[model samples]
Target: MKDFPSCFGENGVQIADSSSSSSSSSSSISKAAQNLVTCVYQCKLRGRLSFIVLTWTKHLMGQGLSLQIQNSTSQSLCKVDIKPWLFSKKKGSKIFEIESSKMEIHWDLTNAKFGCGPEPEEGFFVAVVFDRELIFFVGDSPSEKIAAVSAAAAVFVARREHVFGKKLYSAKAQFSEKGETHNVSIECDTSGGLKEPSLVIRIDSKTAMQIKRLKWKFRGNDTIVVDGIPVQVMWDVHNWLFGNSAMSSAVFMFQTHKSSGSHSQSSVLNSSSSSSSSSSSYCQQQIKDSKLQGLDFSLILYAWRNE
Candidate 1:
C-alpha cells in the first residue's frame, strides 16, 4: 500500500489503476475498486475528543464497510470491519476497551437499504457508545435521531469521494446535515493539445467558478455558493497537465470552511484498519495531523484521468 505522502499528487489524489485489465472491458477490476465514499466525524470518545473514519467501498468481488476511531492524544479507540461474505458477520455488536473504558459498538445492516455505492442510504443503524453514552451515529432516521439525542453529540466534519470520469466528473454533496444534496460537476479539458487547459466547476448546472489559464494555476483555490452557502474550492491539476503513464490523476477539494488537513493524503484507505493488534497510532496520526478542528464539512476529490 502507498502511504499518503507517496500516493497523493499536487492537483488531486490518485485513486486506482489496473495494469492487468484488458482494454476491451470498459469496467475492469481496477475501475470497480475506485468506487468508494468515506465519511469522517469529529466526536468525543470516553471524554477524549477523536476523529472517526467510516469508509464504504464497492468492488467486483463484493461490498465492505469499516470504521476507525482515534482520540485527541492519537490513541486508537477502536476499529471494526464488516464483510458480508459470512452470514455471522452481517449484523452484530462489538465490545472493546479504550482507556480502560468499555466501548460498545452496535450495527445492523442486514436489512439496510443501499444505493449505487456500498454505503447504505437508509434502513440501518450504527452506534458507538462510551461509558454508556452514545457518542456517534451514521443515520438520521427518526429512531436514529432519538437515540442520538441521548448520546454525546458528534459533528460531521469531512468527506472524501473517489470518482471516475473521462473529462467531466459529477457527484452529489450535502454541505451540512440539514442542507439539501446538490449536484456538483467538474469539467476540464486538458487534452486535444490545447496550449492552455481550462477548468469549470458547477453546482446544480450553474457555473459556480472557472479557471481559464490552467497551466499557470494548476494548483489553486477559490470559493463558490451552493444553496446560498459559501464553499471554498481547491484544485490540483498537475497530473492532467504533466503526468506520464505512472501518474495520471488529479485531485480537488470543496469545503464550507477553511481547515487544516493534509492535502497530500488520499481519502481512499488502502491500509488495514484491523491489522494492528496493539495500537492505531499510525491511523490516528493521519487524522490528527489533518488539523480538522473547528471545521464543518470538507469534500476531497481524487480525480483519475482515463487514458
Candidate 2:
C-alpha cells in the first residue's frame, strides 16, 4: 500500500488538537528523575503537554523534558521559561530557541506508548519554511519520540501545499549532537499499495521517512531551486492525497525551486502534462485518504492565506 513516507513524504498530518500547560514542582535531579518515572503513568490520562524531570542521584539533578510544539499562530509567540523547574542554580538549565517562526521544543521524556526498549535513542527535530526562509532544529531524542516528531514533520511539510500550491515546499528531518547545520530533503511519492497513503522521510540522506500519499505534482525529470539549492523531483498523482479517482495528482516536489531565468529551458519538458482522466483517479484517492484520516492532510487546502 502507499504508506506514509518514512520521513516526510507529504506535508500535512492529522494531529490531535492539544492544549498547552506546564509542570514545575522543583526538587533536584532526583526529583526530576522520579517525576519522569511517574509522569509516564499519566500521559494517556492527561490532555495538553507535560514535563518530567530526570535525576542522577538522590541529591544531584540533570534537567527537565517538555513536549515540543509548533505554533502556526499569526501572533509572534515567545519562548516559555521552564528552567526554574529543571535547574537548581540560576544558570543550571539552558533554554535553546529555534529561530524559525514555527519551531519544536522537547515535549516529554517518557516513551510509554512505544514501550521501553533501551530508551530508543530519541532526538527531536522540527522543520519550518516561511517565505524565503527554511529552518530546522535538533535536540536529544529517543527513537519512539522521534517517530512522533517524524509524523509531525510530515504534517508540517504537507501543509506547504496550501501555502505555496502544487507542493511548493517540502520538509525533512535532521539529527545532531552539538547543534549545528545539516542538509536534508523531503520526498513525496505515490507508487505503491492501493489502500492507505504512507509518508516516507530521509534522515541525513540515508533513512527514508514514513510518509504516504502526497499531492503528487511534478513528473520526474523536473528540476527546481529553493534558497539557492537544487532539487530534482518526480511526482505521481494517482497515489498522493486526492485518491484514485480524483482530478489531480497529489503535488510532490523537492525543497529547491525552479531556477530563475530557467523557465524557457524547461518549457519542452513541462509541456507534457497528465490528462484529465488521470487526474480523476488521483483526486479520488486524495479524497479517500482525507475521509479515512479525518484531517486536511492535503497541503493544497492550507498552503495559502486563503485556501
Candidate 3:
C-alpha cells in the first residue's frame, strides 16, 4: 500500500499513480489519477453528491443537507447531477413530487477588482431552485453574498404570503453579521391578493458564510424626496465581511433638463449612508488595502441543477 500514494476521506478515496511500473502504463495511470482527483474535488465542492443521497434517504435517516468540499474555485464546478438522476429514477412513479416556482444563481467571489468601471471587476455564479422567481447574482464576495442571500430569502417569504392572499404594505431591508433575516408584516386576507403588505429584511453580521464583499445597483422607476421635488433615484449597496460592516445609499437622483422645453431638472445623488460602525479612518484603510484583487483564481459553482 505504501507504494500507492493514497488520500483517504470519509466521503471517498484517491489513489495516485506509481512510478514502479512500465513507463507507458505509468504515464497513463498518472493522467487518469489526476483527472479523477479533479472530478472528485469538483463534486465535493458543488454539493451535488450529498444532495443526491439526501433525496433518496431523506425519510429513512437523519442528516442535515450538507455538501462536502472536494475542491472549490471561481470558474469551475462539478457534482452528481442529482435532479436529472432523480427524474430518471422516478419515471412512471407517482410517489413523490418536487415543487418550486423559480430558480436562482448566486456567486461567491474570493478575489475581485471592484474598480471604477462600467462592469463588475470580478465575481462568480451560483444556481439554485427556490419557491418563486429565478434570480441571479453577477458578483461574489461577502457583500454580494449577503445581498444574494437576502434577496432569495425575501423572495421566498413573499411567495408564501402571496399564497394566502394577504395585503402587503411595504418592504424594507437590513443586514447584520448573524445572517439575513426578514420580517414581513402582512394582513392575512384569506383572499387571493394583497392590498397593503410590508416586508423588512434584516441581515446580521454573522452568517455571511464565505463571502468577503458585495456591491449592487437598482434601476427602475424609484423616486425619493429631495428638497421639494420628488426626484427619480437609484441605489447602491456595498458590504464587506458580510453584513458585519457595510454602506448603502439611494442618493443618486436623476438630473432634469435645464434647456428650453424641459420642465424638470435632475441629477444623481450619492449619499454616504454607510452601515459600518467603524470610523472613517478604518474605511479608508480598507478601501486602500483591500485584498480582493490580483490573484490566479479558479471557482466552480453549481450554477444549475439537473432539473
Best by lDDT: 1
Query: How do all the candidates rank in terms of lDDT, highest first?
Result: 1, 2, 3
**Candidate order (TM-score):** 1, 2, 3
- TM-score per prediction, in order, is 0.74, 0.21, 0.17
Candidate 1: deviation at residue 68, Å? 1.1
lDDT tens readout by residue for model 1, 1-307: 1122211111112222222233423334336437667777777554545777777776555667777776654455688988635444656788998778887877877677877867888877778887777888776443543364476667877677666678888888898778898889999888857356789999889998888777666665565666665566766676577655533556677766443232332232211432232112332333333334333577877676676
* Candidate 2 residue lDDT tens string, 19-100: 1012322122112222221000001001222111111111123332232332322122223332324443321122344353
Which residue window of length 10 is worst by lDDT in model 3? 154-163
Model 2 alpha-carbon drift over 4 Å, by segment: 7-218, 239-251, 255-307
- Superposed by TM-score, candidate 1 places the C-alpha of residue 115 at a distance from the truth, in angstroms, of 2.5
Misplaced by over 4 Å in model 1 are 1-33, 84-88, 140-149, 258-294
Report the Cα lDDT for candidate 2.
0.28
**Model 2 TM:** 0.21
By lDDT, is 1 or 3 better?
1
* lDDT tens digits by residue: candidate 3, 1-307: 0122112222223322222243434334332222111111112222222111111111112111111122212222222221222223211111111222222222332343333211234553223323332222233444433344534221110000001111222222211213233332222111213332111211122221111112211111132222232322222222111222121111111211112232223222222334432322332222222112211111111000000
